[model samples]
Target: MSARDAPRPRVHVVHAHSEADSFVTAMKNVIVAEFRDTGHQVTVSDLHAKNFNPVASPRDFLERSDASRLVYPLEQRHGYATGTLAADIHEEIEPVLAADLLVFTFPVYWFGAPAILKGWFDRVLLSGVCYGGKRVYGRGGLAGKRAFSAFSLGAKEGMFGADGIHGELVTGMMRHLFQGTMGYVGLDVVQPFGGYNVPYIAQDKREGLLDELRAVVRNLDDRPVLAVPDLDDFSEKLLPLHENPAVS
Candidate 1:
């Protein structure tokens, strides 16, 4: 289709940052502005601002399969099948279901995602809804959709390389976030954009990072989706076949 005649994508940004004026928040704002300016619709789930309940407890299910004991995955499957999930969970799922592009923005904490964002995956990406059993990875529920991570870290850029103390950035932190969670759910994940040494960067450099963030947001569709192994690539035992070796 011609560029103008093409359908505009629905972008959903899940922002997880405690401080409203933080670098992570600024990144999210840049994404929103870029997408909106480019004629795409955008929805943001500001987790901290909403005071999202990060804990996945028995309260998540309205009618528990077993009231005496709490088995999270089983309860998640049951709730999804029966439409008995908590109101909050349902609220989170709505935007995701409607989105064509999903983006997660946060500040890396202690070499990992913020606790709240981690909980977001635990709760929002429930069984039988986002993923389950054979319906995972390349065959996941959100297969046709796209997602990405844009995060900032306190550590310097040089520390994330292969020989650096932090190890390879992509295969390290980004892998845990993008490949593990987002890709597992069948969303074609894009390579993450990291704003390294965010806390100590100069204003000029920070502004440059902001510009880069805007560029990424504006060209979301142009980015390549990271390849992930499909269900067919696995043997009956769920192990990878040599022909289509699984990505670590």
Candidate 2:
């Protein structure tokens, strides 16, 4: 396809921070705007701003609380409460299914994803569709999709290395969470771009971080990577779907 005729990359950016003024929130806005400027279809799932319901409801129980009747499917009750899941899912899933890239923008809290974003994972990346079913072989339901994460932190960079308080770079900590979990579900992770020391960094340093963030989006791979089976059933491997090294 020609540049204009080529399918524009679709990105589902899930923002997890509660405050708009927070550095992570600001980064989400900037990244969305930049992606849009490049003609990508950007769908922002503002988890907190939407007051997204974090806890799964009765419908998620092994035996759904309500057997009244259903519109989508009986299995959907196992997916999420049709009555209580955030309405945004209706609007979000289409783009998510169509998306070429899925970007999660959030602040790392307690060495993990923010609660709201984690809830999104719990609710949206459901059992039947996103993963786990007779149709799937531990291969993610999102088998062909790609995932990326951009994180912002307020601590000094030195606090994350082998000798630091966390004793791991931000990415190192995210590997299992991102790779083992999300990657296991079929999304190949690109090297994540993280901004550290946000609270103490000077204006120039923050600007530098923004530059790095921009590069991350600009450099996003046009095609997703393929996650295939490894020798063991418990393990899996990923290979870049596209052969062109220049694209990376």
Tens-digit lDDT string for candidate 1 (132-233): 887888888888898988999898888878789878886775677778889999999987899988989799999999999888777766888887876776
Question: Distance from true position, residue 9, model 1, in Å?
Answer: 1.2
Clashing pairs in 2: none
Give the worst 10-residue stretch by lDDT in candidate 1: 239-248
Error of 2 at 222 (Å): 9.3
Q: For residues 90-122, write the lDDT of model 2, one tens digit per residue.
A: 555666778877888888787778778776676
Give the 10-residue window scoring lowest on summed lDDT in candidate 2.
231-240
Instruction: State TM-scores per candidate.
Output: 0.92, 0.76
Residue 223 CA displacement from its true place in model 2, Å: 12
Best by TM-score: 1
Clashing pairs in 1: none
